[model samples]
Target: MSYERHFEYPLSASSRLTGSLALGDLETGQRCYREGRLSVDGGRSLPISLTHSPATERLMYGGEVECIEHLRTSLREMGVELPGSGGRWLPGPLLLGSERTRVTQAGVLDCMRSPAFEEALANRQEGEVVVLPVLREGMKYGLQEAVCDVLGAHCDEVVVDAHHVPDESVPYLGRRMELSVFKDADLTLAQREKVKVAILGDSVASGTVIIGLIEVIKQRFPNVERIELVAPLAAVYGLARIAAFGNEAVPLRAHVFESLLNALPPEYYFSPFFPEEEMHMAKRAYSNYRDWWGVDKAGKPIAETACAGYGWSEAFFNPRKQIAMIDEQLRERHGMGLAEVLGRY
Candidate 1:
């Protein structure tokens, strides 16, 4: 049975963090990474996204090649472009899409129409930092690629094949995080010598994986002084969980795309809700769900089916299973296939 869920993430006023974050703030440069506006109801505080970008607004609409192009082109104009060598796109959000869109190799390498070898001369930052990407999610691998693309390949990198499974038996916020995977991941002495900052790039929902990675970093890299979280989409619960670890000694900072998401209820991992304006389901795919699922109090079309992050962080890792999961949910909810739902029309 589908459990009733009301989207609400209430955090205590004193400890809740908020504010705008720049892309460069993902390093130790910005001291005040924890700053943003808060949404309050009565005496309790609510989780909110640090929004102020046209890219985030763009995401709420079309989920096509053009949408990706516009974002990349805009970023290039802002001096951040990534053109894969030999006509290849490093696996990022484009290829590692959600259940809404399947994976594809075709990229925006030709979109903005940059001069030949121009993208090769992309932004290069001389930094003593390591970009640590959690393995399995090909989407986040893009972040790892991006750091090297912009900061030069000489930037240190450590891939941690760690995993975190939530214990559903306890409260969602206070649930005991069980580390299912923690190997002896490390950086060489040369990689760690001057590397004081660690930039971790990944999509955070419940923030369990990050919590585990932090433990690994503390245990392995004691020389590291600062931690920066670069998650494009994250839940409020996850950010708050990581925020608790921030301090003057080893300050922790976070950088989200445009907004913070509600961690839902019970199991908070499936809360990267797709905005009604952003979701672009084909008529053959989910037009019926628009009617059956209807709208939510927020006017969201089919609140249940609108979550863009349906298959967690690895939608592209196992495409077959991702597609199957989407079909299964649609069938289980509407009690029929899209054809039957379309027959009425």
Candidate 2:
């Protein structure tokens, strides 16, 4: 029996990759590549013609072609864009750059869109300083790291928000932190005992970095009991809770952190931007989770009355336990796993 198949964007444009067309029938258990206009199949010579679009990267069948359902299914499963029932093609998301760009392509495209930024990048030279005035707070460090990696040139200095803070402040902060971590002389007894990890960024990609760090910590320091992760924006609340409830209490345990874990909508897990719609959805989800948990705005677990007290930060310190708790809550409420969620990022 003969089967019909529709292909979209079937041709390869770049010489770096080779594309092939496979044809076959199931019963004969034979397959062949279309090498010429005429091919001998099942003791009969058949004429075939194939056309391709260089601009659109789409393919069109010009003559009668025979295939099998298995081949069509396999192509579809391999992420080949194929035409649907009405002969309409379904396309995937448009990626920004070539294979060489890979992870840094997004940063490159973002830079290119702004003419001023592109000009600045083009004019930059080794051992020179670059100042970024209006870059987002969370994206500054990551963007600098990515640009430096992609360009293969290092700037003597990169400054962020020079108007508000001194030029030395940002670099000093990073260097001080690095020295405190790597230099043995700078570590105090208490600091050595407590491992403090901070993921200070606003994007979901930052959150995935947090997840990967937690996994690495679990692998490298299995016995190190005290591990703290500081979320910069939420640190004030965490510290308040610690101060109010004392050292033994777990911070953001009842509602705040729980709400964060539960409020994350499925789509926002891997999305680059956190827009207003997602923010509203997250607020609603957080409220729902708080209501379900009988927690009030003040971090109190009260079913009827609103209680006033701060939450602690012990949860941030115990990463393994916190990850386990998050996984449990997500599985119980959303039927999702932490690994699955992080995989999207």
TM-score of each: 0.56, 0.21
Question: How big is the positional error of residue 299 in model 1, measured in Å on the Cα after superposition?
Answer: 9.8
Spell out the clash pairs found in candidate 1. Answer: 18-35, 18-36, 19-35, 19-36, 49-259, 49-260, 60-278, 61-278
Clashes of 2: 5
Model 2 TM-score on a 0 to 1 scale: 0.21
Steric overlap count per candidate: 8, 5
Candidate 2: give the clashing pairs: 227-317, 228-317, 241-311, 251-312, 251-313
| Model 1 C-alpha lDDT versus the unseen true structure | 0.43
Off by over 4 Å in 2: 1-101, 104-113, 130-329, 332-345
Q: Give a tens-digit lDDT track for model 1, residues 1-345.
A: 111122335333343333221121111111112233222223232222232222332232223343345434433443345343233211122323442222211111111112211232244334456667666552343444555544455565676565555465543344444544433345565555556667676667766677657766665567776676655566655655554432334555555443345555445565634333222212212333334435434454444543445565545565445444544554664454323322332
Q: Relative to the unseen true structure, what is the Cα RMSD of model 2?
A: 26.7
- Regions of candidate 1 where Cα sits further than 4 Å from its true position: 1-61, 65-127, 138-140, 166-186, 245-249, 274-300, 303-305, 331-345
lDDT of 2 by residue, 291-327 (tens): 4334323444321121111111112223233335444
Best model per lDDT:
1
